[model samples]
Target: MQSAVYPSLAGRTVFITGGGSGIGASLTRAFARQKANVAFVDIARDASRRLVDEIRQDVGVEPLFLACDLRDVEALKASIDTARERLGNIAVLLNNAANDDRHRLEEVTPALWDERIAINLRPMFFAAQAVVPQMRELGGGSIINFGSICWRIGTPDLSIYATAKAAVHGLSRSLARELGVHGIRVNTLSPGCVMTERQLRLWVTPRKQEIILSNQYLKRLIQPEHIAQFALFLAADDSAVCTAQEITVDAGWA
Candidate 1:
C-alpha cells in the first residue's frame, strides 16, 4: 500500500457503508492501516465477514461489519445504532453505497426510476442523519459521499443513475452548510471509470474500454486505492477546511 497522507486514526471511529467490496472495501483497508476503529455495512454477509477477518488478521484492528440493506431506512438506522454502541461515536461516516441501473431512456419505467433514486440517493441522507448526533457528541466528524463522473459527462443508458448522483452533490453541499456550525463536514468524492469487479463484469467490454480510454488524458484505468486515498484525506483532519465540494479522482477524465 502507498503511504497514507494523514496517518494515526488511532483513536477515531469510522463508519463506512457498502464496504463488502469495490471502493468501500478498499477504503476500509486503508483506514485500518491508519489505525482507525473501522465499522462497515453490507448486505452480503460472507463478503463483509471476509473483509472483517482480513483486516483483523493483517492489521490487528477488528472492524465491525453490519449486514443490512441500506435501502431500508429503518434497518440502516438500526445498524448505525449498533455500530455506535460497538465502536464508539462515529468520527467518520462514509456514505459509499450506491447502485447503477444502466437502462436505455425508453426502457426506464417510473418504478425503476424511483428504485434507483432510493438506492443511490436516499441512504446517504438517512445514514448521515443517523450519525450526525453521535458525531456532535464526539465534538465533530466527516461525511464522505460517493459521486460519479457519469453525472458530469453524461452516459447513454444511465440517466436515472446520473440524476441520482447529481442530487448527491446537492445533498453534500446543503448538508455542509447545515452542519458546519456543528463541526461536521460533508463532501462528495466523484470517481471516474475506476474498473472494479462489477464494472468489468457488467460494463467493461473491449469496445467500451477503448471508448472510455479515448476520452481520458491518462488512458489508464483508475484504481479503487486512488479513491481510497482521497476518502482518507476527506475523513481525516487534513481536510478540516474542505467541505461541500466535489473532489474528482478520475485521472482527469472529467
Candidate 2:
C-alpha cells in the first residue's frame, strides 16, 4: 500500500527499535517516505544494514541504523543519544522491539521469564526514560509502544509474553498523565494477527490460519504497513489530542 505523507513528520527525528526486520522494517520505510529523519536500532547487523541500504535507495535518505541489544539499558541509552546527536531531537519514538517466542507455561524458568520480560517490556520504559529529556527540549513528542492482542485473546502458550504486553497498557496510561503536562503523548499500538515473514515462517500453521480467518471480521490478514499507517497518525499533529489510548489495528478481531 502507498503511504501518506505527513508535513508534521518531515524533518522530525523518529527513533525505532527492532526496525531492521518484520513490522519494524515497514515503519522504517513509512517514516522515510514522510521525509522524517528515521533512526533505528537492532541486533541483527546484516539485516539492519540491508534495510538501511534499501531505504537509502528507495527514499534518498539513509536512516541511522544502530546495532545494539535493547536488553542492555546502557547500550540502548547510548544508541538513542547517538541518534539524537546524528539525526536530531527524537520527537517520535516507536518502541517496536519485542520477542513473542512461544513457550509452554511449564517451560518458563526464572531466567527465561526474566529474559522475555526484559526484551518485551523493559526497553519500552528505559527508552522512554532516555528520550523524555529530548522530548522536553523539543517542547513535545509522541511515543508509540507496540502491544499485542495475544494477551487479550487469551491465547495460550504465551503466558510470559502476554503478561508483558498487558503491562504495556499500564505503562502508557501512567506516563500519559505524567507527561501530558510536558505535551508528550503515550499510546499503545496493539496489532492483531499481523502476517509478517517471521510469523508466517514460525507460527502460522493451517489450523491457526483457519481459526484466525474465522475470527477476524475482515477475513484478511493485517499487514505491517497497516500498523505503520496508524502509527503515522499518532505521530503527526492530527493526533495531538490523543493519548493513553489502546489503538488496535486487528481487523476488528479484538
Candidate 3:
C-alpha cells in the first residue's frame, strides 16, 4: 500500500516503544522514511539492530535503537533521555510496546496480573511523562498511545490485557486535557486483529482467520503497515486538532 508523505514530519524527532518488530517496526520505518530522527526502545536486541541496519540500507536513515526493558522505569527514562540527547527534543512519541498473550482469568495470579500491566500499560504513562518536557519546550508535540480493540469487543482469554487497554483510553483523555495547553496532543490508536508474524504463529488459524474477516467491514486482513499509516497522520501536523480521540484501525471490526 502507498503511504502519503507528511512533509511536516521531516527532521522531527520521534520516540517509539517496541519498534523492533510488528506494528512498531512499521511505525519506525514510516517515520524514518519521512526523514524523522527516530529513536526506539526494545528488549529484542537482535531484531532491533537488524531494523536499524535495514532502515539505513533502505532509506539511508538509521534510527537510534536503544535496548531497554520497558518494565524498568529508570531504564526507560534513561533511554528517553538518551534519545533526546542523541536525536533532539522529541516531537512525537508512539507508545507501541505491548504483550497480548492470552490467559484464562482463573489462571491469573497477582504476580501475573502485575506483569501484564507492567508490559501493557505502565510504560506508556512514564514514557509520556518523560517526553512532556521536550514537547512543552518545542511548543507542540504528539503522543500516540497504543490501545487494543479486545476490550471493546469483549474478546475472551484476554481479561488482563483488555483491562489495561481500557485504562489506556482513560489515560489518553486525562493526559490530553492536561497537556493540550502545552500544545501536546494525546490520543489512543487501537488496532484490531493485525496479521503480525507473531499473531499468525500463535493464533490466526484458518478457522480464526475466517471469523476475523467475516466480522470486519473490509474483507482483507489488517496489516502492520495499515496501522503505521494511521500513526503517521497522528504523528504529523495533519492531525493537529485531533486529540483525546480513540481512533481504531480495525477495518471496521468492533
**Candidate 3 backbone collisions, by pair:** none
C-alpha TM-score for every candidate: 0.95, 0.98, 0.98
lDDT of each: 0.88, 0.94, 0.95
Model 3 lowest lDDT segment of ten: 245-254
Error of 3 at 195 (Å): 0.6
Query: Candidate 3: which stretches are off by over 4 Å?
Result: none
Q: Better model by TM-score, 2 or 3?
A: 3
Clashing pairs in 2: none
Candidate maximizing TM-score:
3
Which residue runs of candidate 1 sit more than 4 Å off their true CA positions? none
Residues 111-134, candidate 2, lDDT per residue (tens digit)?
Answer: 999999989999999999999999
lDDT of 1: 0.88
Tell me how many residue pairs clash in candidate 2: 0
| Global CA lDDT computed for model 2 | 0.94
lDDT of 1 by residue, 1-254 (tens): 55764764667999999988989899999898888888888988988899889988999988889899887899999988998898899999999988884788888888898788888999999999999999999888999999998967877788888998888899999999999999999999999998777888888898988888888888787888888988988998988889899898887773
Sort all candidates by lDDT, best to worst: 3, 2, 1
